[model samples]
Target: MVRIAIDAMGGDLGPRATVRGTVEALAANAELQVRLYGPREALESEFSRLPKRLGADAERLDIVHASSVIAQDMKPSSALRARRDSSLSMMLDEVASGQAAAGVSAGNTGALMALSRRALGTVAGIPRPAISTAVPTQQGGRCYMLDMGANIDASAQRLVEFALMGEVMARRVDGLARPRIALLNVGVEATKGTASVRHADALLKEMANINYVGFVEGDGLFSGTADVVVCDGFVGNIVLKASEGLARMLIERVQATFAAHWGSRVVSLLARPALLRLRRQLDPVRYNGASLLGLSGIVVKSHGRADALGFACAIARAVQEVRIDLPRHLEHELGQRAATAPVALDRRGSGVSPCAKTDDFNS
Candidate 1:
């Protein structure tokens, strides 16, 4: 069975959402097992309320008692020093101890990244972990983007590392043979971006295995122009949050337009199915999990405000990564690149900085 661990008290809904998601995940996949870490009373209370039909699935579920929880506003440093007994920490402990293949949480993003790095460490030659997730493309495909806010400032070399990791993620998770990689910039020209982007572009062009496809602008993110888009955390985080906001605005406007008049209402009745599909396509909840790529173990962070179904989607993401053995593949890929090109593989740990808290639970 593929065993996964969860911080049941991590999100805004706490055990109310997590326990339900756990039971749902367990019921959906017979080969999956779960280790839920949270207060014993809370977990038991939630589980007891779930349908009796899921009782059979509960056989593979285990609850590990955790005494505390890390608050959403807690700093990563404080959490590391004072919240060792927190559910988030305990969940990562299960993964680090080899009792679980992967871990999932909807807790403080900074805390998760800090604790995970200390507990699981990063893969060799990787300075730090990058937050990555797939976004829907106009072509009905998905494009993977990284540094969604793991590190605020990344060097040219760090951008290169993100590129390599994102390429691997697209290939392994999406089954793309040679994912088209691009550097996110202001314009498609080599001379259009900052010094770091320009430098990284030069370096990527020299790497034969990377399949580098020059630069991609912000508009290109949804244009099906590239499979992997690499950028610093500052730019990437803004792009992600803005894209989500824009999607919500557009969807709401469309719905409002459909309800404006009797004539439109009649058409809306006929077009309901297509509109529902469009909403689902743009729903950020469907893409809830963000992988902490480059870590030695699998770690997925769910949006803190996510509902039960969204949390369940996060759990599913961890299971997929566990089965794929993503870290191993990343390590092997880095090793191969280093053996062939020494300059491109100049890897060194740039030690963790004080993790910054964001409005959303993302780092």
Candidate 2:
């Protein structure tokens, strides 16, 4: 059985959402075993309300007591120093110790990132992990976007790293053999973006291993123009948040319009199936898991506010990663590239050129 460690006390909803989500995942996947970490009493109380189906599935769950919980607004450094016994940290410890195949947390993103790196370490040559998730496109396809709030200021070399990692995600998760990579910039022109982006673009163009497709503007993200889009955490976070907010808004507006009058309500009934399909497709909760890529082990970050269903989706992502042994594939790819064409670096042995530090984007 594939065992997954969960941070039951990490999210805004605490054990209520996480325990239920764990039960849901257990019910869905018969081969799954969960090593849930949190206050044993609270977790048991939450599990006390489960139906027979979940109760049966709970047989595979093993609750390990964790005294501390990581707060949503907790600083990463403080969480590391003071909350070592936190559910998040304990869950990662299980993964690091080979007690679990992967780890899942609906906790403080910063804390999860920091603790995960500390516990699991990083793939060889990866300075840090990148937050990545698949975002749907207008053509009914999905694109992998990365650096989604991990590093606020990614240097040119970091952007290249995001590209390589994102490319691997697309290939492994989405089964794209030659995932096209792009740099998100103000314009598609070679001269329009900040120095970091331009430098990364030039470097990517020279790498035959990557299918680097020059540049794409924000609009290109949903246009199905690229398979993997790389950007700094600042920009990636904005894009992801904006897209999710817009999708939620659009879905609500459609529902409101349909419920406005009796005639529309009748039409809505006729279109119920289509609307449900659309909602399923557009709901941000459906794609609630963001992978902390470039780590030695698989770690999935669930949205802090995710409900049981959403958190289950995060668990599902972890299960998928485990089934495929994602990190090994990434290590293989990185090794191949390092042997052939290593990333370009300046005299300082960094991805940035002298002008990159002054670039408005990185700054």
Candidate 3:
């Protein structure tokens, strides 16, 4: 069984929603073992009420007491440094100690990233860790988008590395072998966007590691043009928020329209199945969280406003990631690429450059 350490004190709803979610996830997947980390008395009190509210499977749950709790408004680094006994810190400690396969939190993202880097470290040769999110496409497929908010500013080389990592994750986690990758740009043309996008485009086109399907505009994100989309965190965050906002708006509009009158109520009854299907497709809860990749240990971050179902889904995702040995697979792939790729040269002519010697060698 894959063990997941959860930050029971992090989210807005506190232990109630988180504990409820834990119960729900346990019920859904019997093989999952959750170690709830938070204030001892609070968690125990909540657990006591779960048997009557959620059921007797509460026995399967484990609790690790954390005296201190980090607030959402607190600075991530300060919170982590000052409150060493916070729930998030304790959860990460479990992951680092190998007591838990992964850590799941609906806590402050900045704190999570800082704590993760400090605790687990990053994969070799990776400049910054990235947050990879799975976005549902119109073709009933899911496209993986990376650098969601990990690194707001990135270089062309960083984007290229993110693409490679994203491709590996898409295949390993989503079971998509040879997933098509596209560089997210303003236009579909290779010449589109600023210098960063252009440089990334050139590098992607030349890289033989993954399937580089050229450029894709923002509009094509939901159209399923590519299985993996790469971009800097700034742009990726915008795309993520836009998609979320649109989904929420559509759902709200449908709900308001259906409540207008008797005629619409009849129409709503007939369309309930279709609406539910649509909700499930775009539901943030279903894909409730994203993984912070390139870190040595797994860290899954969920929405701050996520309810019990969303938290449950995040737990499930963490289990899947651990079961698949995500970090080990990434390390192997990245190490292999680093080994095969030519080493970087200094400004002085210490050795023959691969770019310059290629034609001469072929001749």
Segments of candidate 1 deviating more than 4 angstroms:
51-53, 350-362
Q: Give the residue spans of candidate 2 off by over 4 A.
A: 53-55, 343-363
Candidate 3 C-alpha error for residue 320, in Å: 0.8
Q: Report clash pairs, candidate 2.
A: none
TM-score of each prediction: 0.94, 0.91, 0.89
What residue runs in model 3 are displaced by over 4 Å at the alpha carbon? 51-56, 342-363
Clashes of 2: 0
Per-candidate Cα lDDT values, in order, are 0.84, 0.81, 0.78
Pick by TM-score: which candidate is best? Answer: 1
Q: Which pairs of residues collide in model 1?
A: none
Rank list by TM-score? 1, 2, 3
Query: Could you tell me the TM-score of candidate 2?
Result: 0.91
The digit string of per-residue lDDT tens for model 2 on 85-129 reads 888888999999988999999888887887777788777557756
Candidates 1 and 2, the one with greater lDDT: 1
